[model samples]
Target: MQFTFALFAAAALLTPVYSNEITPMSRRETGIKLESCTTSQQAVVEAAVQRAASLAKAAADAAINGDASIFEDGKVTYNCGNGTTQSDCGGNGVLAYALSGNNKIVNCPSWYKIVPAIDDCGGTDQGLAMVHELSHMNEVYSPPTQDFAYKYNDLVQLPTEQAVLNADTYNLYAGAIDLGCQVGESKGVVLPDWMVTEIMNNNSK
Candidate 1:
């Protein structure tokens, strides 16, 4: 249940963002790269990487392309599509899971580029989408699909699964809060009520 949404989801919210602080990711090697996109979009991605530094670094090390000793081993590449229908960004972001490895790509869709969309509970659609996909790049949960991020969804909390679920919940809410707060400041849009509620609920916990 990876909830998919367009750029419109990262909505404007001036609320208190984080209630539950995210434990910092134990950083890893920067084995990831970005292959396509304009210089401007590339800059946007650089900013995104800086904002999500730990997750980005984790994504890098999680890839073991060929032999561990090889320089190009386990390298993951992301291409910023032009937010078109026929894009690798696959409606904001795409996570590919394979027998060999997993790949994540995000389309850098600007706030203005998105058509006027009605926000429901998804003010941080693009931001959350990006975070969700990047989080999956770590492969800690080993969910069958690359898209199954446990956000507002149930995960069976068996003893073996409880720890993973707890971690997932933290990351999901932390990113949600981050994206929610940034939306209003950067995107200049009003946060949907649902988004505010969601943020408040998470913060309360």
Candidate 2:
């Protein structure tokens, strides 16, 4: 049985959204109200918009066969200043974006991105990056049991306890990561232990 399961796992690794492209002023519809202001304010809005865009893409990509092109028109709108809009940043703070599914993805501070470069493409398991990120998306939309628990319990502090929620989801995430690493290895790409550690860490949490 163990050998058969391993063979099945090896096979799955090989395997691989309807969004409005032409919704006019969809920004307002989506509650994104952009405002023109100082350099800093504009920068915040732009950053928020971009973050939202990435989140939207990731969510859509998870549903598809990892194809990002499906979410071409899923733009992120920003609420400038004044805080009148739901997407507006507070007092020149970074902007916020909400998905059609009512999911929120925030833009980080400017200084943070500059310091280490968010998504700098570090560590090995480059192919796993997409899989890992997609796991995050799965957490959002079709959250497995553990992920669902993570929402209630602070996963950052007590990562290990999350295993109590549901073992199945945890296994799914782990399997996905392992498959990613295997796929990379098959293509002659070597992944560092650190990258593998990160995947394990995410699951434990």
Candidate 3:
């Protein structure tokens, strides 16, 4: 049993997270507010938003050039059943999204909705997913396009403990780092400063 558990742990360490994620999407109508969502959901989203807000300013400052209204027009939505929203993105691994047509700063969308995984609601999973999706929103100004795992190999493990920061996409390092920071701040699951910096600065956008 000991050997078996050790083998599993080692395998888990090597395997990069491919999917089972969350993201934000756009909404036209009044949807689930942060207050209305489950407790776990709220905790996760709030933490993500807090950290994202912090990063928004610092990140923009880092570039020495960015938009002012980034992460300002954000909202929340709850997705259940198999087919929800445009991507149906409702599953165990492919959990959520912060949907946008393209990775452009100027043509930003009006309403960035932080969609939720309802089935995962009412528990720790909800909070985790909320943070995951918010990290997706961190890309509101500049949606990622490069696969983050290629750049930051431990991306799947470093950032958060609640949910896996799906590193399957071509780009998501920023969101993952945001997720990690939020998780650490809110849940006391902090990572090393160097790792956090590497995740944020390497493949942000």
Candidate 4:
């Protein structure tokens, strides 16, 4: 149920020009390494990782003076493989995953898009999905937990304590900032500025 937006030009005009108040994290800073993926896939991975890092940085800046406490060190290796053979592939609509103890590695399916479009707040793209995976890495969240609040609906209703830990919360927060809109706008569950403010407020408390 992925929604595609063919409004890149319109989106570009709507996308905010993020300031340099806090330097955004780069792919190198994130330490994301791709294996067994095509050159085009690698490029998409790079973009996705960079996007996640920048969004994470933005969240940190807005929440706690650019303190990226969860992103301790972005050292994760991504391996592309067939969905059928890989564990956690295509389960419950999951796009990627990090094994329990081997949190340094993320398994992505071969069918994973090389260049997924920028998602509206209602839907997810590869970039947003990768952000969800990043949140599971030990380097991102120490003692990485398995309880990720999935989908837009769960993200909005998440309690403060759970919202701070849920991977999808981070994804939606990033998406909210990237799209400059409320979460679930397309799904008709609009909460004005909820994603941007709620998580930051929770972190502040």
Candidate 5:
């Protein structure tokens, strides 16, 4: 009996034990890495990333699932600093940006807002900004086009094909889901019928 017990103990000791620490679903699925951020900044980023993931998942559960699938969730490193002497963030009122085909997201100094619980449709916040950058990742869309509009007003007027390819369209769709409001109701801008239908379908679900 003692030999049997010793054998069991030896076997248990030799078994490999795995860690219980589980990575967040958002970080795991999106491959988002936060670098060189303060504690508060990290908190803001975490919230925004979580919100963006939630928005993406919600969109995936609707008729616009194809749009949500475009995110790709590729590896992206986010930094809280002015990009290379403020080249992208200097004077154009840009909040955050990712260079075409780049795996990095640089947040301009002005991009310090926390993810807001949007109360109205057509409103933008940090989470939407993250969504925009995710769309710009090369893994998500190659040869990212900069000609498409990012502003809500202009986005509503873009052709359906062009709008689908624009980063801001994802932002707006995600934003609308976050707010639980329809884009047309808030801005009085008539989006393409397909977009309106998709938004309504998402909201209804």
Candidate 6:
């Protein structure tokens, strides 16, 4: 389910004036590449990779190709370095890094077969929580999209401190994917409202 906004005078009016957290020319040059992954890690990466590819293709079809969704299967690879600057399963500051060189989203935790730790609630799929970082990758080259996502994320998590707690990273990516679609909808791109609902639902999770 993808959402797109209608392009109109509202576009200029509704478009958010993003902040410095994102710069269109900015590039995330630092981070580790994922060369390999365990069965579990591979599953997670495969799911995210497929979804990302689908979204990227949708964006292109809608003509919103703002460089927000350019990732693909072949363009992506993995690195198995664990506890060495790159690794999911909570081994370092960042589990994965989506580099700007070729719009590659690196799966840092390629070594770990399973996610190391869960959230405070013992949630699954929360281990390699690189969704936020991947969002940053999409926004790194798209400043407006980043600003829009950050603001939307804050709004979504504002209802509870628990939601925002330790949410600095998580919310950003979720917001990017969510609001990116929402913004697209408002820009005249044809997307479904269900997509927006899914994004909202995911953000709450």
The best candidate in terms of TM-score: 5
Error of 3 at 61 (Å): 2.1
lDDT against true structure, model 5: 0.57
Using lDDT as the yardstick, the better of models 2 and 5 is 5
State which candidate has the highest lDDT. 5
**Candidate structures ordered by TM-score, highest first:** 5, 4, 1, 6, 3, 2
Q: Write the per-residue lDDT of candidate 5 for residues 68-118, one digit (tens) a residue.
A: 223333356778663334455756567787864557888876567433556
CA lDDT for candidate 6: 0.34
Better of 2 and 5 by TM-score: 5
Query: Which lDDT tens digits does candidate 1 get at residues 1-205?
Result: 2222111111101001111343422112333466556787666554444444332222222211111222232244556654434343344333221221445454544422532222332233333344444434433223322323343433222232342333333334444444344335654434334434544543454
- Per-residue error (Å), model 2, residue 100: 15
lDDT of 4: 0.52
TM-score of 3: 0.33
All models: lDDT? 0.35, 0.30, 0.30, 0.52, 0.57, 0.34
Stronger candidate by TM-score (3 vs 5): 5
Error of 5 at 157 (Å): 1.4
What residue pairs are clashing in model 5?
none
The 10-residue segment with the lowest total lDDT in model 1: 7-16
Q: Write down the worst ten-residue block by lDDT for model 3.
A: 1-10
lDDT order of candidates, top first:
5, 4, 1, 6, 3, 2
Better of 1 and 4 by TM-score: 4
Candidate 3 residues lying further than 4 Å off, grouped into runs, are 1-36, 69-92, 101-151, 154-205
TM-score of each: 0.40, 0.28, 0.33, 0.67, 0.71, 0.34
Error (Å) of candidate 6 at residue 199 is 8.2
- In lDDT terms, how accurate is model 1? 0.35
Residue 173, candidate 1: C-alpha displacement in angstroms: 2.1
